[model samples]
Target chain A: MQIYATIAELVSAAETADLSLSELMIQQEVANSGNSRDEVWAGMERNLEAMAAAVKRGSTGEGAFSKTGLTGGEAIKLKNYRATHQSLSGDTMLAAVQNAIATNEVNAAMGIVCATPTAGASGTLPGVLFMLQERLNLTHEQMIRFLFTSGALGMIIANNAMIAGATGGCQAEVGSASGMAAAAAVEIAGGTPEQSAEALAMALSNLLGLVCDPIAGLVELPCVKRNAIGATNALISADMALAGLTNKIPADEVVGAMKKIGEDMPQTLRETGRGGLAATPTGIKMKMRIFGQDRDFE
Target chain B: MVLNYKSVFDIIGPVMIGPSSSHTAGAVAIGHAARKIFHAPATTLTVRYYESFAETHRGHGTDYALVAGVLGLPPADPQVPNALTLAQQQGLAVKFIEMAGPSPIGHPNTAIVTLSNEQRTIEVAGCSIGGGTIEIRRITVDGFELKPSGPLPILLVWGAKDNDQRIQTKLAKMTKIMRQQSYNTAAKHLVEFDLERSLQQHEVDSLQQGAAELVYL
Candidate 1:
């Protein structure tokens, strides 16, 4: 796609170049509009809350569980079951995250994922930081510095790619998060933001077009599991960026590409229940057979 | 820029949980995806979180967050708690997993959400990085990876995907025109902005106004 080509050119121009992701983000935000950095950052958080509410509402609607008539305690029990058995390996960062989410610690740690601003993607980074610190003996200051560095790359991805998955897909969602993590890992390991952003860009570009389909409208099956992979990708992308191997695509161009790919996506692919895994026969059968209705087919 | 000398930490807003703006928002996107994917009454669901998501799920209210999404609630809806309850009352099972291992390729905020039926099971893996953005990482039926984003019936409509050819073509030229004109009236659409503004205004009464503004953004 031309979008991909532009992004490749942009990345090439940036490869081996020196720049911080945060700096890039500030530049991107400024380029996008006149909203103050703080204003844009605030908007990011607001969007986060909006996204949160949307998930909750979807579950409560006539999507899932309305047929069996489950209970709160049952929900908790089910949650526990999910916690007990699920495993995907990549790196130590993945391990730490696994421990945290199983324990419910991501939201409290202040991870910082850099949506429109730093506070928006709080869950991913903090969880990774806390896990790394505990397992890797990373210092508090190191964590903070790492965050700053990671935020820099995150900003780049936000500027280059669609940070909002509704605007794109999991490629933008986890891909951007992993980009930040990759950059932060680089920073924590003593790489420059230039290196970090490169790694981040590489990560985003690599993990594009991942979908966002949850069965019965829940964030279970693959939502939480992908975070582990995203974390691991962050580490790997950092390594790739550090090793001096990256697509010659500008982060912004990648963002542009992501937006286009998402546009080409069908409603089912776009988080609307119309495409991807959501449209499968199993998905349809689950809805119809479980709910005792034919609406799934209709 | 003058040296206002705000603390560097001060420059940073409230701390939070993650995936990334894209991942987190992407999770919401997945919720939206689920809403449209099934097109039926989502009755019972099972959510399983992997590595990073498990650790931070609680603070992010990822559990409730996803549930809220399933309920068709907006991200700013304070009724997230009620929605969780409502899910249970309706007989839905939302699960959380901490996948403790590795994978060749994927995001950190991944989840394997299963919406089952008497005869079939649909499993989806969606990642929420940061900013509540979500994307479908992978999907499984009888244990197989399905490229959900590649030939699926779904489509994402936004500023980035407004047209077919141009890059970053969200809403084609509409978003461009809006951005250029600054005429997009999100003031009434987003609730969180109003709530944040109310809080920023330093007025007590206006706080709820901001809170009520949680929707429409």
Candidate 2:
């Protein structure tokens, strides 16, 4: 895992090792943990199972409220809406959106979720993976491979730049997860590693400079809904890469750009919940209603 | 690029109950660590959320998560959200204070807590370093600081700086000992060091025989 710090290194290593990104990541995990291949794979399989259960609870349950009373049943509503109406985004995209919403909703409700980097951005990877699972009729092996591939990309971002909003803004959280999902989706869709790398760049470029400002400082509000967009972003980027489109900027440079942008952002735009949507009139009202105090924000 | 060797699972999984991993799971880790190091009964707990944690504590369940951790609840426990009610049930009075504006230093996500019982009080300063990882920056048992209280086994002693040699000798006999810090006052010195492995209960009693207090974790 420490061997490769950037996507360029990852791709080259894949080529040299004559292995796919997922295979290389699995090897690294095996070497690092001194665990048998079966044990590592089974451990990730458990995480996937937990992810699926969260989606089930969020999309099917009568919709529980978060501690803040913000974020809960939107996932179920979207699921119901997709069932009855012709979604403008089409079934697969809509399904991904709902699934993304479901996992984040589960997080908001204090249900268990596997943080794909961080819990605030947990939904994007699972959203993209499960949708591909259903759409491509992927086996458990393929799904686990998707996760490994996603983890590989996330590792690069986490190593070279950041993945937590507190350090890198929403661009680091949902943005990193989206990029990871896009690259993984491309690989599982049988696109070349180069194409997957291109998708990674494209997905990150689409959401660069995004801020992390959850109203009332909760992971509800924008966080859950943003993951839906992240899932869709990954989908389009994967499609673009599969069609041979590429980013002008290299994937690693794009990640570097995101880091710079996040550094330049004011504290309010970070996870302080001080500025952006968190500072909106309605946001302040909600905060007062929930916590009975306005943010001491200037 | 500065490459931090965070595991792929660090990117993928803690499988924690959360709205925000840093605020909830990281906070839980801090409280849990503080309690593990305190290793004593706490009648009252006072927590101060700093900077980013202060602003977003309530929304992220940082409050419940911290209290839950002190109550020995893991981040995955479904009861984390119900921590406040549970605290009341157990008669642990918890106080929370949120401070706005920027943190002067350290990580933006930070929490400082004091857990006090009848005879003693333990103070801990912790930072949630994102991705559900935490840094137990300062763990103080009655002003005795534990330096480098990381994942390593720690043996902290509060006594005379003169006893530092004796304690080192006793510690060396038990395991490999590397002394880290010894902060001394007029009458007492808080000697701190990391141990190769945990010390036995009888060994701890022996170390505390002439010392004011000794905590082993």
Candidate 3:
């Protein structure tokens, strides 16, 4: 059986146990109602401004912004997907995404169904929702609520720990995202926060040491299309959570495990190109070639 | 019971990937954000996915997503992976590489989406977080995390007086508008507006332009 007496108890435990969740809730705003949302927004804005200031101080450099020109080239492809979905009006957002990706796009496509987030990860939520929606079509509001729920979970991960490749490794970023998304999916489908947290704990517990090492360092290499994979995992986690298979360990504990794993990771595997696959000769050659440091340059 | 509406689950998942939603979906979101931000054709580009993306990138279809993104593919595009091969076949010289070390601490799925021509490189790092929310983290051309999620249709105005304050104010106004217009409703507008503003700001150009790009699988 679970340890908590109620959902509030579980959330409180999570909040106290983790920084991300606590921050996401923005503890200062105890007042309920619409103002809470505003407070969240304000908190986010303040963080953004502060981050900007840090970036200016040269504290935070370009993490992944180096590949700007690629987006322009990708426009035509995305447009086609959008066109197909738009034509299929009145369809559920999940279906629209699935259909769009299935028809026009290429290497891989995944849908985010019940607890969807970024469009890149769009398929994950839709994919889950599609399967569930066919059984029971929920409204758009429900979908949004699912996302909000997921967002709440995501904020926890984002705050208390790491959602970046450099800090927590890839597991902390995508793994955390998938966990939150899974929690959201289950919640939207009528699961409880215990279920949501369980899903998150399950997801994170499984993906403890994922690293963030993009091929070529471009979002495209494994970045943009990884949504399909993220989506799939989100569904898997959601289903497990819904099924009542909870992680005996709390979600916060799992996050702690993740952070410790990341900290213990070698620099090469820590998105630093010093370890893991990045240390391969091929990787070295590739790095040289990409940076114009290859033999040809000599 | 007050209906604890949190989307918590008891048993969920065989989650797809991790260490980054930004590196994954956030990246695609960035691609889509770019399409909406530029609303123009992108002829030349230099993409970089960090270490995680570079390693197992083929499995994740980041290549396809970037190509599809450049071509204006939606976030939901299935051919995101195939788009890269398609683009390569088209002679776009869509190069790929692995980057080293962490550049900054914002969103992990950070990419400098530069809408450019031979004359100018209007670069921007589209920071896509979970749920398709994006922020123009910074512009390489001019250093500033001017919120790009606004509907004001303003330029980055590099070095413009009160640019930061202006952007912040605009974003505040936009979020206010979105909240007022759809208070009870979940605000999709906020996400879109935020991305739009980030895309137009061209923040990514300032830092990682012409550098090695990485992708994680």
Candidate 4:
């Protein structure tokens, strides 16, 4: 089986085979690994199970503080707020925000999480998928298929550009994850592969050049909230694509631009804990406190 | 079976403990891969972190993750957070070094570790590039760098130099070899095999009894 490194090639292959993007990805896995379809599907099912478990444990787990005590209870706070008050983002979007935050909370607490492209940006996909499952009443198979769909596009990003924050910044981490979630959303909502591509481009463009700076160098603060916003970003992008909207630039070019931007980014902005939020007064102070360092920044 | 494309699992899986994949899980993977390459229990372990790995080791739990790996814990093990205590209880004398900023040595997420048993001391260096994926940069045992990449279900077999034909003769008796690549370096011959599946421990034990220096799954 030939590999598709770009959105155009992937869509063309999907159309030629008359298969949904999810099915094409499943086929690709079976071909590459010499595994039966059932085996490949079962593998993705395990990932889905892990992701769902993270979501559950994150929301309900007690003493949720991260090892650093920097990020912990925001997801729980959101859930409580949602139950008592209406959100401007609406229930589905807020639900996505809730789940995304919850999942990252689990990650920050050193709990197990499926790296949807990466652990740093792990929450966005599940944020959207679990909310969709609740809203659309999707079958277990549909939930698993959503992962295969997103994972296929994520591989393209990983190969062509990258999904690493160190190499590509948050644009590549949460940004790519949001784009993957958007594409998967379109497909699960019965949109064509082409529409999913547009959705991906829109999602990437929305968060282009986002840096990967965490206060104290922890996956707390902006990183956790970023997932919440990333979930909403995917939701809005999917809606636009499903509503017959499209970006002027192709999806592949957006990924390319992300790569170039990340390359041009300074080392400090790329997970070095030296710039962006990590360089701020409070961020630096917190870093000193957490690490017990006395090297005061003049 | 050198795949030109990555599997989807490469993107969506590797369920791991994390505040950061490259720092935490990647460190665990590096430690675990080093342990696998050693193929023996280690007593004294010295770990050195470089660049971003050094800077964020405290917040990201890179220290615990690396210790967890040296202790033979998998990347996702919940025991990772308790690794420092666990290592002490297990009588593993562990030393961790975090390099100061801007050293001219390694990638952002790099780990250079030396593990010694009573008889042998081995050095392994690995880089966690991103997304829970890692590249094993160097290994002291057989210089596992000549051919850095291969198909999965791989085995790095250490033996005498130019022993490919001899190892092949030995390996064929065990299982069909889909593909094989070998290089002789640092007085060690390393043969990488794309096998039908991961070899069972008994099978590896039987193979190690041959002239093979070490066999790692």
Candidate 5:
């Protein structure tokens, strides 16, 4: 019951056990937590159901405005636009983007969300999972397996590197989420475990040093739109890995690099709303507008 | 560290009501833990919000969530936003003091909660480490440090004037004790026990009537 600390070890364990990454993860969960496989699957299925419900409620444009009135209805707008007009990104990608936005919008509006790694980046995995389910004609069980695969990757990152924006940054929140989703997408597409790791590396490297700067210190504003971008990043990385693209650095090394960068980052960049876009003039105006004054935040 | 992720739920979901996981859910968890430590509803409470939590907790609903937690509401409870009003109606005198600068413990999102009644006081400090998970960094009853985490049942016994053997004899009957630690100062003796199975409510009340405090983690 030793914890797997790196992608290489997890892949090796999967190979030795003669199981896929999702199967290995399920086994590990049963061993570590004393839960039956059926019980674990039931729990994951519940989360999947909740995520689907959030997506449905959010996409319908039902009370999406957050408390600060910053971000709302953008997901519905995207869904509507995709319905009437042809998007250059195609229906599958557009659906991923829309679902991602929808989930995060629900989160901002204080609706329940399944935090894929964290609530601030909750949208990416569910977005890609539901979209690919339709496009690939995947079953419910397959979508559950995809969540298991993503969970395995997320566990490794959280154990070895970081996953909290306060501890690392948005690079740790959305970036880790993007990596998890990309790896899951690779698994759903029938790629090897190593290929999935490559997808994660590619996805994370693209988002290194990303800050957690929510406007007015709310999880609305850029957070909801960023989930859209994170989902798109996940899909693109998954496609590249499926097409035989590889990262120059190993996935473990890239995760280490992310941890190092997070450590070196100033406090202002790590969820304090003191730097990045949160410090912009528009950001200040929004804060003033929401709170009715320039409150002494710092 | 053991990297405490035992299931996929810890990674992909807590299925919580939230704007920020660390701020809202984690804050609720801290308050929940504090409530458990007190063994009864806190008649009076003082909560200290530190650093980033002090700055933006209102926006994230951390303030409401923490109050809801102490009122025995779960993180996903819909009434969390109205917890303060509920606390007022319940006659729980709660006060919040926003502390400037980061905690000495270094986590940006931290809270120290003190719960008290006419006879006793307990203080607990906790950090929400994202994704609705939390760590109980410190706990002090009187002046002795006690550590408890998760949902296990805990028993704390402070002997009268160093009468440690009297309490140890009483604890011998509890089934499936997971951990036991003891602390001693000049005037008092403290023994902490963590159990696999929770003590019955009657058993908890019996212990409370004595010199012991039974806490459910």
Candidate 6:
């Protein structure tokens, strides 16, 4: 059997196999690895449980402080504020953003987290999934299905483009992550596989050319905040796709474009901590303050 | 190369302790793989951090994580941060050399590890290919490349001169071998094979007494 390398092939495979994207992924896992479908689902459920636990631990405000004191407490503050104030984005979206922040904050604090794609981009999928669980009243099995759907899309992107910041900047990291989350959210919201692809395209296109420049070379600072933004982007893009929106460019083409942009990007911008926000004067000051002195880097 | 996203866990999680997956978890995996290939923790170790890893490994906890892995700690272990001090108290001679530029093989996140004991020396080159996934590009023991992926149980049988008949006949009886790779250098003949099941301690000892060494990954 041929493996699906592009979104079009994936969608067509799902259609011909008479499977949803998530089902197609489950089938592929069985065929490729020779594991039973139940085994694969059990492993995914374990990850889901870990993600939920991280989210809960992170929202409690304790142990949120990162080593460098860069990121912490924002998730707790967001959760606390939502209890008393009427959030313009409403409770679900606010909770989604907070959950995303909480996951990354935990990650920055050296806590365990399920890296949705990578640790730096870990928060987006869990944030969107848990919020959708409450807002849509999704069952645990449905949430697992949502993960499979997202995995299907992420597989295509990772195979076609990249997912590491060192390889393709933040666009490939958080951008690919958000695209995966958006597509999964669409699937949970009753969007077709094609609409999920559309959501992925829109989410990735919006984050194209985004550089990977964490201040002081830590995954904190802008990274934690980027997960929050990525979660919001996933939610909005998913909604847009559900409401009959489509991308001008196809999903595979968008992935190819991202690969090209990453190739063309200067080495400094691709997580070298030499350009973008990392190069600002304040970035240098923070690095000096954190490390106590500057080391030689030529 | 086609990136393998075999399972949903590959996409969603490794559930690791981290600041960075590529730097921390991946580094640990490489070191752990080195330990496996060495079969025992080395008394002295030399690690070369190349390119981006050399520049930013400190901030990412790559150094401590790699040492923790060498001590046989997993990525999720909370004891990772104390690996440096632990290595010292254990009396392991550890040296870190910062290479000037990208590796000659050209991966940005690459580590070349040299592990040595009184009896043997092993050299392994590995790269952290993001999200706690790694590729063991090359492994050289006694000047022959013994390529093992580091996840499977591999028995390295060396010093058997006759590769065609003697080694294969013996290997066929020991266990069911899934994959095999062979290399020949000046002094010895080496064959590495992944077993369907792990060998007993007696089997390992028998293999080691007969051949040069037996390594189970």
What's the TM-score of each model vs. the native? 0.46, 0.85, 0.45, 0.89, 0.90, 0.89
Error of 3 at B209 (Å): 31
Stronger candidate by DockQ (5 vs 6): 5
What does chain B score (TM) in every candidate?
Answer: 0.53, 0.72, 0.51, 0.73, 0.74, 0.75
What's the lDDT of the predicted structure labeled candidate 3? 0.45
Q: Give the RMSD in angstroms, all C-alphas superposed, for model 4.
A: 3.8
Q: Could you give me the TM-score of model 6 versus the true structure?
A: 0.89
Candidate 1: where are CA atoms >4 Å away? A1-127, A288-298, B1-79, B83-217
Local accuracy of candidate 5 as per-residue lDDT tens digits, A42-102: 9999999989988887898453668777888888888888889999989889899889988
Question: lDDT, candidate 3, residue A125?
Answer: 42
- Residue A61 of model 2: what lDDT? 61
Model 6: clashing residue pairs?
Answer: none
For model 6, state the Cα shift of residue A185 in Å: 1.0
Model 5 segments more than 4 A misplaced: A294-298, B147-180, B185-216
Model 2 bad stretches (over 4 Å)? A1-3, A67-69, A295-298, B1-5, B141-217
lDDT of 5 by residue, B1-217 (tens): 3354545777888888878888888888889988887777668888888866776776788888888888889877788878999999988888887788778456788889899988889998887776777767678886787765532345666656344455455555644456678887887677777654445556556565457444545
Compute the lDDT of residue A90 as modeled in candidate 6: 84
Worst 10 residues of 2 chain B by lDDT: B144-153
lDDT of 3 by residue, B71-180 (tens): 75554444554677766665555565555545353433445555554544545565443333344444332222334332222232222222334344554533222211
- Top DockQ prediction, candidate number: 4
Off by over 4 Å in 6: B145-181, B191-217
CAPRI quality level assigned to candidate 3 from its DockQ score = incorrect
DockQ of each: 0.08, 0.40, 0.05, 0.46, 0.44, 0.42
lDDT per residue (tens digit) for residues A91-146 in model 6: 88889999999999989988888888889898988889999999999998899999
Better of 2 and 5 by TM-score: 5
lDDT of 4: 0.82
Question: How large is the interface RMSD of each prediction?
Answer: 13.0, 4.7, 12.5, 4.6, 3.6, 4.2
Looking at model 4 chain B, report the run of 10 residues with the lowest lDDT sum. B143-152
What's the TM for chain B in candidate 1? 0.53
Candidate 6: residue A225 lDDT (0-100): 85
User: Residue by residue across A87-203, what tens digits does model 3's lDDT show?
Assistant: 443333333234223211221223221112322233344344434446467764454455445556654555456555655666765576667767767767777667788888887
